[model samples]
Target: MPKSKRNKQVTLSKTTKKGRGHKELIINGIRDAAEKYSSIYVFNFQNMRNSKLKEFREQLQSSSKFFLGSNKVMQVAIGRSSSDEIKPNLHKVSKLLRGDAGMIFTNLSKEEVERLFNEFEGYDFARTGSIATEKVELKEGPLEQFTHDMEPFLRRQGMPVRLNKGVVELVSDFVVCEEGKPLSPEASRILRLMGNMMATFRLNLVCRWGSEDDFELYIDGPGDSDVE
Candidate 1:
């Protein structure tokens, strides 16, 4: 073989070795993460500056239950696992690969997770990016009916609206939703409140373990008799 050909082969070998080492490290990290956490939420962000990303990282760090990992490494780690439970949900995570991703690991029940998501939904982080998911069209459907019913509810919440250029806009100077555009902060706040209320009402438990009967003896009977 020529000298240049030998050097090229050596470089490729080094790259492959590095890739395998990183994959192994990520696999170990995934195993550790799975052992420590029962729920993981993967999120994607876009167009955010390094400062804003750092801010988000700091916020997640305060929670002490979140883990963010490199996509390639994580995928390798996940592939080595035999567990099918977490694997199925991993499909929803492909969207994260398209942009910046942060994974949240929590011991919270699914209802709690949904609540947290709803709470943060209204938070506008400098319009970093659009939800890469399919756009939720506001056609005639449950959402439409809810939006109609919510007009009064919004007004009650101090977000009155007015028709402007064939679109609804908040009347309050503090709350403005321009036509053919995304929601403003105040508008988003009201929407978040509504979403949280709906989510709370429709809370579904995704995964649950342990026995409720373990605490039964701590309570008194219906007749006020001690049931120790």
Candidate 2:
């Protein structure tokens, strides 16, 4: 019986936790991006289009970074609710991560961010629940765009249409959608039938936070007022 060497116990860092590697990556990325960019914006997006967002990211690769993920993970990444901020005063950004939001880290000025958002929006067909931009109505007449064979399909979409003289014709004046109502499936179909698109992709920079200053609210939209 000689001497037995004592075993060394090791503790795992937060980054090494199982199934949480992505969370750790988010935290590290936030810290690194904060150090590199002079401005950080909290943004809310309508209609998530992955491909378009990818292109947008590519356009800003030279000087900006976009971080979109679970709000809780992002809250943790920025050292929210604690003095252990990754970067000075930047942790306050986590408070704005409440709903349908993401983060933009950039060295671009406020004007530049506004310009980028204004010039770089994608438009698409409105989906169910999207508010109609204008009143959509199908007048009582032949629809020259559609052929007679599409009558049954159009009828199934709640349209009062029939194949008359080898063309789809509305039997009556059917109001597909109103200006302020949530679009129904039938309304969405009618919009496509008429070759109309109602969804306009947009981004609102609700708040901005810097490493040295507190949150500044952007009041271009409703309910964005900062509490005194």
Most TM-score-accurate candidate: 2
TM-score of 2: 0.83
Look at candidate 2 and give me any clashing residue pairs. none
What lDDT tens digits, residue by residue, belong to model 1 across residues 92-113?
3322333355555556665665
**TM-scores of all predicted structures:** 0.36, 0.83
lDDT of each prediction vs. the true structure? 0.43, 0.80
| TM-score, candidate number 1 | 0.36
Give the alpha carbon lDDT tens digit for every residue of 182-210 in model 2: 99988898798777989877777777876
Q: Which runs of model 1 end up more than 4 angstroms from their true locations? A: 1-23, 62-69, 80-99, 119-228
Those runs of model 2 whose alpha carbons end farther than 4 Å from true positions after fitting are 1-18, 220-228
Cα RMSD for candidates in order = 16.3, 10.4
